[model samples]
Target chain A: MSPKTLYDKIWDAHVVHEDTDGTCLLYIDRHLVHEVTSPQAFEGLRMAGRKVRAPEKTIAVPDHNVPTTAGRENPDNMTEDSRIQVAALDKNAKEFGIHYYPVTDVRQGIVHIVGPEQGWTLPGMTVVCGDSHTATHGAFGALAHGIGTSEVEHVLATQTLIQKKSKNMKVEITGKLLPGVTAKDIVLRIIAETGTAGGTGYVIEYCGEAIRDLSMEGRMTICNMAIEGGARAGLIAPDETTFEYVKGRPHAPKGAQWEAALNWWKTLYSDDDAHFDKVLTIEGESIEPTVTWGTSPEDALPISALVPAPEDFKGGKVDAVRRSLDYMGLTPGQKLSDIEVDTVFIGSCTNGRIEDLRAAAAVLKGKKVKDGMRAMVVPGSGLVRAQAEEEGLADIFKEAGFEWRLAGCSMCLAMNPDQLAENERCASTSNRNFEGRQGYKGRTHLVSPAMAAAAAITGKLTDVREMM
Target chain B: MDKFEKLTGIAAPLPLVNIDTDMIIPKQFLKTIKRSGLGVNLFDEMRYDRQGNEIEDFVLNKPQYRETEILVAGDNFGCGSSREHAPWALKDFGIKAVISTSFADIFFNNCFKNGILPIVLPQEAVDTLMKDAEKGSNARMVVDLEEQTVTTSDGESFSFEVDPFKKHCLLNGLDDIGLSLEKVSSIDSYEEKASQARPWV
Candidate 1:
């Protein structure tokens, strides 16, 4: 057989059936569900009179709409819509015989983080969820991507999804990263290099010296925003780091089974002669702590840069730049680091892990959040929150005037009480910086956790290196 | 699902790049379990002011474009989030088709599943249709899936490519789950083999 990429090897292994037109029925090894997207899917299943094909392989959690406040036990305090959605998930999970993590469950948190923490998202598996950030699981070498509600219902009924193979694109990051630079910066830089739609029809496999050196958490941060760069999925080959991360979690294979899985996972890399449709290389040492200055993730620039003028862009982009500047209330030549923020949010599927919390805590140590600026730290999952408390990271945040909250997708998308008022500017550690993503008329500037911490201290988009 | 062989309707022109899903239907509207009733909130922020009044200048709010069944939008339409609510809102608003230079992969797929045909044309063709669509309610555009062509009111025509399988499914208004059930035996055998090979999963 010809040489195969890591994606090819995984895709071939999961094919249940194929058509002459290159369409394949890919078997899904794991399905992660959340409240917001699963309600309609469960309704669709009921309307069709179907049963969940593999309930054991499916897991449900309510993250997007649950309030991150301390008093979340009483559903009455939640907005009517939020209350209904969470209740619907509770009903659906029980009816479908799916494993569910309720708001009170310590295991409950963002589905993306919870899946990996539980060892349910393993290497070489085809994982899927209804949220676009499902690409977060690809860090484990799983062929994971987001699916629509229709696909969600279909998967519930048939453990299979219809898919066409995407062209393979190789993104190589060479050299060592700068001290303050992080996985989030590398990904933001990648999106800035490849415009928003550059990876539209391909799956990017990130590889090279820098990529190999990242922890599984860091790799996940890079893959989490593959959707922002317009790729449905991004992948990294499974190595020792991947195996070590998966070793003793609840769902991981034990003893002999673990040894067998490890042996197979060792072979999950791309062959030397594997063909790639496109290749892009970035010098890791060149990346700085990056942040988005516009509504799109592609509007990222180094913290040392200035707000770009519309004239700095050309053709159709000029109008977009102008619109973004107007919406962000930014002047053309303003320094990025000088812009003040009304809020600082430090958590999400993107940077809610223990490593991210530690990064932020290190920056906040012995420092206080700027006066009058509201800041909060929401861990990615309940377990992550517990670990942070055990590590005493939570106390550091609280002492610094940051509200350390329970785990969920707090202000990332703001379906809960953690929302921005109209025109409130926030420096966040979430994925998308799209208009109104954090709240109504909320302005979001995406950054890494440490950068968010720096912003909290300075009340602006500050460079972490400066704080260091 | 509904069969979409052809559609001839008033087209609304929205030429903004990166029209993200959050713009199509905001997160606040996603709490519902039903797919219907979202049309009222389609482009909710752009369509209405903070006080809940319609922004008259927004194309869809204009009288001529009120009943638009097709959209001539900018590149990378539906560019963020896999809400699937984006397509649901568009379909609920009675948008039968959309023409663009490019589309994000997940949005393009969701469009088909929701009976919305997202047509990809060259920049020139889109420019022509965009200008033609600006002519208001009297101007009409036709999309024929069988013929694989989009014709403007002025008789200009352009052909577009679509996957044969997706085209077939759209033509028949097929239920994907029902179709997959046809091969249950194959799925069972594959699962059995996979389990034997890797029982830990």
Candidate 2:
């Protein structure tokens, strides 16, 4: 057999057929659907008069556009528009024989977080969602990517997608990471180096010492924002770290089946002489706790650096930088560390896991959020919320004057009522700082969860590494 | 999907990079499954003031652009979030074509599926269109899909590329579901074999 990358191995395994025109019917192991992107897909199915080809392989959950008010009494209280969308999902799933977790269901949460926590994501499988952060599932060694609603419709009807094969790119980080630097910082650094569209037609595989050393949660944080760097998907080959995380979860194989699955997973990695279309290497030791000062994820810099001037950017990118500065109300040639934030959010699919909460708690223990600053921590899922409570991570956040709320995307997207006020600047631990993403006129500066916690205490874009 | 053969309409200029889906239709309006009735909410936040009053400064809210059926936007148009609502909203707002230097992969595909022609031109071509769009209702650019060209109202012309398969799909209003159903027997056989091999899944 020819030496192949892990992506090629998995992708080839699932390709049903490839046409002469380069169209493929790629089998999907898991199809995760959400409220925002699935309604029209279901409508497409209804219009086509077809049924889901494999209802057993599909899992439906409503996360986006769901209210996160903690202990909401009735579905009636949800905004009329949101209520319509959520109810439509419930109606669609029941009609199509797909399992749905409504807000009332305990398993209901963000699809990306819930998929891994429940073990629906396994090694060497292809997963997809209507949501872009579906790349988060790739951490488990699955080939996953976001699809447009039309593709969502195609997947629902056929249990397979007409996909184009993406090029393979290898990004190796060779040195050890500093203490306060995290997967969030490393991923932001990768994007800053690659520019937003550098990965346009590629599927990136993160490898070498730094990526291999990360825990499963850390790897997920990196994969979740692979789309932010314009990659179709990002992957990390499943090692023992990946196996250990998936071993005992609800949907993981058990008994003798587990042994067989592990044996297959062991062979799922790329061979020693695997080929790649492109390769990039980064020295990890020098990376600082990074943060974004501009709109795009690629607009990131080390926390130790000053805000960049338009001249610092070259060619077509300078206009983007100047526009970002204008929208963010930031001045070039200014220090990023001195920028004050009125809000700090410490959760998202990017860094709202148990380990992320622990890291934040480690920094915020016995400290307090700055006066007149509003800070909050919304866990990604109910399970993460429960684990945080069991470990008293919630109490630490509350004690530090941060509002500890229920699990949801929360201020990460402002889908619910949790949003930034007009012109409010937020130090956020989520992906994407696009203008008005948090809310109308809201400004976001992306950082790690620990950096967000530190900023909450200092009321500025403080470097978590300096405090450590 | 609506048939998209050719169009010549006034183009509105929205020169901002990363014009994400959230800003296109917004999460607030994503509730309804119906693609219609979204034109009122297109660029809801930018077109309307906080009090829900129209912001006269917004191009779409201006009287001259009220009937715009073409859009000339900035680079990386329709980036962020894989909501088809972005294209749906634009289509509902009577936009038949969107011209930009580049587009995000998902949004670019979504546009073709939803009967909106997303044209990718160079920065200079987009600049010329932006200037022409600034001329308001008088500037009507012709987008001839058959000829693979976009001609300015003053007869300046630029050619663009489109994937041949997608171009075929758009020309005939072909949907992927109808196309995939062609392999139903092959799909069923594969599923049976797959189930036998991986029953635990």
Candidate 3:
């Protein structure tokens, strides 16, 4: 028999029982809910006369539809739609007796960011949220991933989820990362190599020299995009770096319990000679500043690579290629570097960490955004915002003509009032560049935070290497 | 109450991959957290043309697929950000089940809460279902919630299994909150005793 991977071990430990249909009733350790997906579940509960089973284990936060700029003072600043949504979330959380971090609470931001900042994210835990970016918590060595609304309700009621075990995939990146290369670049390169659906049905364990050297923030940026590559979750085994980050946090265990927890987390790594369903390796040196040229994250290339021609997709996918180009208003064979952007957005759970802001600020030092270019920088969380301000990064952004705003999922998926006008192009640090992702008919070019800052300064898709 | 043991209806075909939440319900409509009243605007951008008129070429616009209760979608049916509204919109559009080779993790789970069954069949199973659904409006398919089986008008039957716990919850219309409330009496009793004993509250 082959040695089991860490995913298999963790999954086995959580399995309650296998149902007749082959799906296992796995116990969930933590449940995170948001306003956008919780209302219907709450309504379902009401109609059925149900009460939240373990309200203490469930946490709710309003992020997706809240206006990033509006604090508690001007609730009216939130659009009528978002305001209603936020209010509904608040009502449901209160009625159900679930702990809610409302927007009025200074700790509120994106659910993914809130989970870790509140010390709710811990190793060896099974965390589920209604948002796909729930995989962001996997950075803590937890078995975290997103689920559906029904599952959300199920977990809320039973503190458990029905799931099938996923296969294991190991993605190893070796070699020292060159300067100016960030985890965003690493994930983009991974997606570019593996296509969008490469890791389907697999839990990806990122390993090797490059991953071991990454800070918790960098590891988070890598794991945040696991869904983009079709992975259920991406994880890094706990190490000294992980311990240092979690020690003395608000919710982390203290003293002897903390030592015991650290011992268990240290053993969460894949066993020697562990077997994986699939394995892929990439060299860190081969990676360069990356960006998405087409609609999908997989439709990406290094800054040096030219935009693909329609004919390049010689197979039946020519239609897809043509459709993406037409939607993006890009001509075939045009260099991706030559594309001009009307706006620059730096936010979203994917790249809204303090480190992301610092990277952008470093690129924007003494450089101003071009006139007429709309640039907005929203931090991922209040904690991150405070740290950025303490370091004077917010001033650098404000001086550079970028609107430094409060924390929320701003300009990412255009859920709130912050949206792009029709047909406007934006260079964004957020994930996903699907048609009208920022707004209806809006074109988004996905890039790293530093790259977004460079584009804001130049008013085009200029190379960050050149600016550096 | 009439038990909804099975659902049978015309199938709508959406062949696109990665039909994200934004396309299902544009962010503009996300203002209201309420799950109801979103079905009409479901697929608004695709259902209408640039002039805001209903597009004749769109699948939902066709009279045949207007009452479609089942959706036969392509691979990667739900990709991109996790928004529960995607499933809510699909349920509101009367799609009770979606048959696809694959689905995004979040969207697949969301289907169950809205009374939508997301079936993840193999590629071969999906191709067969797609062909049956595309045979026009009269191609009625039956999805037996009780048996976890899908039978087409052509006399073909495929059995898919769901967790008995989930099936039980769906059948009785019980949700997480409902299950917890079943023990409310015990909880109240325990709380009464604890408060009397401690008197801290």
Candidate 4:
């Protein structure tokens, strides 16, 4: 057999049929569905009178439009449109016989977070969802990527996807990360290094000492924003760290099955001799606790940097930089740390895991959120919320004058009521700083959990290292 | 889906790079299960202001481009989020073809599935068409999927590459779901072998 990259190995395993034109019918092992993107897909299935080919392989949750407030279980609490969408998912899930975690279910949360927590996203599997953040599952070495709603419907009806193999790109980071720096910073720095379109048409395999040192939760954070860098998916090869995390999970293979799975997973790494279409290397130490200063993730800079002037950019990019600056309402040459924030949000699939809560709590202990500054902490999932409560991390946040809210994708895209008002600036832990992503005319500065917590205390985009 | 053989219409010019999905149709508009009715809200935030009035400066709101069935955009058009609604809104707004220098992978794929032809032309060709599109409603561009070429009012033409399978589906207005059902036997046999080889999945 020829030496294979991790992506190639996974791709080869899932091929149900191959066309002469290189298009392949790939079997899908896991499909995570959420409210915002699945309604039209389910409607398509109904129009075609098709049944879900593998209901057991699908999981549905209502996260995007569900409020992160008390009494959120009541559909009436949501806007009519949100209520209708959520209700539609409930009807479709029950009618289709797929497993569902309602808003009231203790297991309900963000689809990406819920998938790994239940071990549904496993190594060597092809996992997909209608949400772009489906790349989050790549942390488990799964051939995971986001699909369009049309593809979502196709998968439901056939349990197969038409796919063309993506070129392989390898991103390696070396050296140890500095204190107060996290996986979010590493990924942000990578996006800054490679422009927003750098990873287009390629699947990036994140590797090297820095990547291996991260926990699975950290790995998830890195892969979650692979879309921000324009990659369909970013993955890490499964190793001992991955095995330990998957062990004993509800859906993970057990005993002999586990041993057999491990045997194949151990072979999931790219061969040293395998060819790569592109290679990028970064020094981990060079990355600071980073924050995005513009409407795009590619506009990231270290906390110590100044807002860039449009003239600093060359042609084609100068206009984009000017437009981003205009939308963000930042002045040229202003220190990033000097910018004030009206809101501080600490949650999303990007930074809503247990470790994220802990990191924020560590910074908030015995400290109060700046007076008159609003801050909130919405854990990624109900289980994650419960774990934080038991660990007393929730108490730390509440004591720091932060709103301890229910779990969902709260304030991430602001589909719910947790949104920034017009022209309000926020220091957020969610992915995507695109205009109106959090709210209409709302300006979002993406940061890590600890950085967000630090910002909450200082009422500005402050460096966490200063507090530490 | 509509069969897209050829389209001859005014091409609206939007030269901004990285026009993400959120800008196509904001999240608030995504709650609707239906694909239609989104044409009014296409580029909702840009086309309208906070008070719900149309922004006259936006190209789409201009009289000349109001009936545009094609769009000429800058590089990396549709660069963020895999919301299929982006293409749905474009299709609903009567945009049958979009010519760009480059496109995001997921968005490019979504466009084809929705009966919209996304033509990726070289920078020089795009520049020529972009200037031609600036001629407003009078400049009727021709996009022929059969010939895989885009021609401007001045008769300048640029040929593009389209995947054979994708082109077939677009030309025939055939959905992949119906096509895959025809191969159920192959799928069933592959699953049988796959289960034995790796039951853990």
TM-score of every candidate: 0.99, 0.96, 0.90, 0.99
Task: For candidate 4, write residues A377-445 as lDDT tens digits.
Answer: 999999999999999999999999999999899899998889999999999999999999999999999
Q: Of all true interface contacts, what fraction is found in model 2?
A: 0.57
Q: What CAPRI-style quality would you assign to candidate 3?
A: acceptable
DockQ of 1: 0.82
Give DockQ for candidates 1 onward, in order.
Answer: 0.82, 0.58, 0.31, 0.82
Q: Give the whole-model CA lDDT for all candidates, comma-separated.
A: 0.93, 0.87, 0.80, 0.93
Off by over 4 Å in 1: none
Give the clashing residue pairs of candidate 2, or none.
none
Poorest stretch of ten by lDDT in candidate 3 chain B: B192-201
Query: Chain A of model 4, TM-score against the native?
Result: 0.99
Candidate 3 Cα outliers beyond 4 Å, as residue runs:
A18-22, A70-72, A314-316, B1-8, B120-135, B138-201
Off by over 4 Å in 2: none
Clashes of 2: 0
For each candidate, give the TM-score of chain B. 0.98, 0.94, 0.84, 0.98
Docking class of 4: high
TM-score of the second chain of model 2 compared to its true counterpart: 0.94
- Give one digit per residue, the lDDT tens place, for model 1 in B1-201: 789868999999998889999999999899888888999999999999998999999999999999999999988899888999999999999999999999998899999898899999999999999999999899999999999999999999999999998898899998888888898898999999999878899
Per-residue alpha-carbon lDDT of candidate 2 for residues A160-195, written as tens digits (9 for 90 to 100): 888888899999998799889999999999999887
**Candidate 3: deviation at residue A384, Å?**
1.3
